[model samples]
Target: MIHLTLIIVDFLTGLLAAGAWALASAGGAIAALVGSGFVGFSLFRKWRRRQ
Candidate 1:
């Protein structure tokens, strides 16, 4: 019974770790996209001004 309980605890820990990793990954991706978009917009404005 103790072994089964330990197994369940380990599984829950692993699941939580995986969920945290996925959230971090998704957040990083969103940040990168936003950063790139801002950079692109700034560059476009500069180019337009020069023209």
Candidate 2:
């Protein structure tokens, strides 16, 4: 019985870690996208001003 309980605990811990990793990966991607968009907009404005 104790062995089964330990296995269950281990599985839960692994699942939580995987979920956290996925969340971090998605967050990083979103941040990169937003950062690139902001940079592009800034450059576009600067170019338009010279027109």
> Which residue pairs in model 2 clash with each other?
none
Off by over 4 Å in 2: none
TM for candidate 2 is: 0.97
After superposition, the stretches of candidate 1 with alpha carbons farther than 4 Å from their true spots are none
TM-scores vs. true structure, each candidate: 0.96, 0.97
Minimal lDDT window, size 10, model 2? 1-10
Candidate 1 global lDDT: 1.00
The C-alpha lDDT values of all candidates are 1.00, 1.00
